[model samples]
Target: MEATSGMPRPELLQVADAVAREKGIDRDEVLGAMEQAIQKAGRSRYGHEHDIRAHIDRKTGEIKLARFIEVTDDIENDFTQMSLEQARIRDENINLGEFLIDPLPPIDFGRIAAQTAKQVIVQKVRDAERERQFEEYKDRTDEVINGVVKRVEFGNVLVDIGRAEAILRREELIPRETVRQGDRVRALILDVRREQRGPQIFLSRTHPTFMAKLFAQEVPEIYDGIIEIKSVARDPGSRAKISVLSSDSSIDPVGACVGMRGSRVQAVVAELQGEKIDIIQWSEDPATFVVNALAPAEVTKVVLDEETNRIEVVVPDDQLSLAIGRRGQNVRLASQLTGWDIDILTEEDESERRQEEARKRAEMFIKALDVDEVIAHLLVAEGFTSIEEVGYVPLAELAEIEGFEEEIAEELRNRARTFLSEEAERLQKRREELKVADDLVEFNGLSLAVVVRLGENDVKTLEDFADLASDELIEYIGDADNMTMDQANDLIMEARRKLGWFEGLEDETDETSEDAVEGEEA
Candidate 1:
């Protein structure tokens, strides 16, 4: 019922303070660990079933030991619980949930108990140290850190980063870069994870962000926010490309990063073991950015397909190898830096492809419209590629073609319309033969021709179409309809919604809307 006072053990407090300072942990945490050790020892001396507890005085460092017995109406455990009547014998004012504290004399720890207590304290302190390390480094991902190599095992470098040890794995090291014990190296803190043993700090020397961080360290403009490193792509120990942007109009990002006579970039290259770096200016336009990224190789034309996030780059025949780099490295790095898939082509190749496409279009028109080679060639030359374009285009646009009059334009349009109508009838008949589901036939965003194509591809039912991935649907329909991945996804999603696949989502949305309405009313 009364507070327990024990003999002072100031040496324990001193040890706790020393451990806290050395381990970079709170002194209270060390003291609490000491209390747990004392509690465990007390339970060993006293009955283990008794609720033994220990506390150290914050000021006097006195170790207090006691047994706690709960006062309850029902006494289930005789060792740690008592009936309310028995508890009231000691203190009548004690509440039912209150504990009856019986002060016990501190036991003189035996050699075995002392050893056990020491192990407990050491384990608790180690756990606290690991927790502190995880807390300190978890938020430091993507940051550059400097450390000395402590050891190398199986090509993995163990780095001593002052208070903590980090691992630079073999795969994350720059190729052909060597590191021995005691060598100081800079790496990006790729990740910090908590595991069963302790917190693991992972570092990488070959990460693109490591190069960007190096530039940030070397170039004052970048650190000062005048210039920003937008993206980086690296073939570690070989080559790298970095894109930079300047918020200040007068500051040239590329020139600033290059430093005086290329000093800054050279420093990064040296750190990366002579990895070649191409510092390019970043642009908001993907095409412009791609062109800049593929620098040192002149580009004649760039065609961007935004739907696919791909770009076709055309260069002179002599510059083909240079544009593509050795083994396509240049274009690959350009793709990574600009966030676009890049396909490089020589000027000659592009010209041949254009001519081939034109020839195919002319042949298709000649067969579909029953027109002569001259008429089809004129139509193809005027950029008409399909029967739909020829039929739906303004009569004046077709008549404007050289050597074509209004009468000829009208006649060609009629023939194109007739061909498309007849083709639609034929496809419809095929769709019927394929037993295409009516629901799939009526699905929005799909034309009768596309539906027929889908039926031919065995996507005859709504369920079949819904089961297909967006890319698969695009593949099944072919490029004749110019179907985009996004459109395909939308159609599939609509089909799934109609099949009640999104019922749970709809319920959640309805609940959210109702909650919003109720909140407004309140």
Candidate 2:
């Protein structure tokens, strides 16, 4: 080791090694940072405009300082560029695009220069450390990681995860779960982002995937792919529901997750701060899955409305409270796990609703068909709830109704048709009075009744209807029409097309036709 100027200092290599070890960075990277710091110092000493550079020998730790001037045909920069003809005077081997390196003696560092060099080295080392941390943890998302809580700021926990620091946001912590400094915690790596400050590693204990990963760690069947976790829903430290499916028929997914004597599930529950878990067997059928998800409570029936992506669950009156759970937690978790909106109902409530619907239909039949109460009740009992059904069903189907003859069926059909025709005429008169345009009235998929309703809502012209959003149109039409969003969009687009809104766009019609075909296939 030498302290004199223009001499190699062997201690520099030892310093680089120590810094690399302490910072967890590559030795070569630390040496590069040292070289950059020396180069910055050299530039500050020798004119800043000069192309000054520095290098350190890996073997001897010898510092080399130089000014680089490119041998170019055109000299755009006096400090860094030199003409080839002028370069040949100094060295005959110099060629175009080659650099002429003029070595200079290394200078002793002053206090200010030494401090500046230290700052540069520290910044470069920190940058390398941040890059290393990001590369190490960026791909480790969704993995369970153990760390010690370093500190807490504004409810956010900063954990020291060995080589890096991760943040567990307050919202990501389980409800009512408290953590303090020096406490060991396990969480899932939800995300890793490269921000201006550094690479941010976000951890979450409340995420549903955290529980799934815990089960994977505790349950061999899940880790081995014998059982797959289909979905998970968590109410933080309170309760959770996990749906799983088994690939092997002999293996029961729920039983495997539960483990022998509840050992496996208890491990996960303990990690989750005593969160009660309900492990349910997943089914391909939505109805079956919903039933399985709502555990500890018996469901007598489940009616699925695929159009609305909702399910109506019917349970015994005594099971109502159990099905709903405290503050609707059970059904809410079930809905999240199954991805279906659930409406829980008791058997008594369902029965009353059925009777009420029947009564309404019977009254409608009595008024529309001019039938007595007995006839209306018969129609309702026979599942003929609409005048359209009575008018258009096969004559034999109506005649086959008990206590109804062919003549009576024929008479009922005639009366129903008359009532519908008269109603249509009345709606048409109303539509005319409301000044609804004929183009809108005759639009396909817009029934005369729907048109009248739209006119009542002041959507009389095709332009007005076209201006409405799908949801707005559905709202204005009311639920009686059962208009889906897609249907409403189609109707609006058709109106737009008729109003020349899509004019001069050659591909519009083709794209619309292709979409229609795809929709039909779907």
What TM-score would candidate 1 get against the native? 0.93
Q: Candidate 2 — which residues are off by over 4 angstroms?
A: 1-6, 71-76, 82-96, 438-444, 469-471, 484-522
Please give the lDDT score for candidate 1: 0.92
The lDDT values for all models are: 0.92, 0.92
**Candidate 2 structure lDDT:** 0.92
Clashing pairs in 1: none
* Candidate 1 residue-wise lDDT, 140-258, digit = tens: 99999999999999999999998899999999999988899999999999999988889999999988889988999999999998999999999999999999999999989999999
TM-score of each: 0.93, 0.88
Query: Which residue pairs show backbone clashes in model 2?
Result: none
Candidate 2, residues 1-522, lDDT tens digits: the string is 122235667999999999999999999999999889888898999988899888888988989888888999888899999999999999998789998888877868899889999999999999999999999999999999999999999999999999999999999999898999999999999999999998999999999999999999999999999999999999999999999999999998888899899999999999998999999999999999999999989999999989878999999999999999999999999999999999999999999999999999999988888889898999989988689999999999999998899999999999999999999999989998999998888778888889988999999988999999999999999955888887789889988898888786757888889999999999
**Candidate 2: 10-residue stretch with minimal lDDT:** 1-10
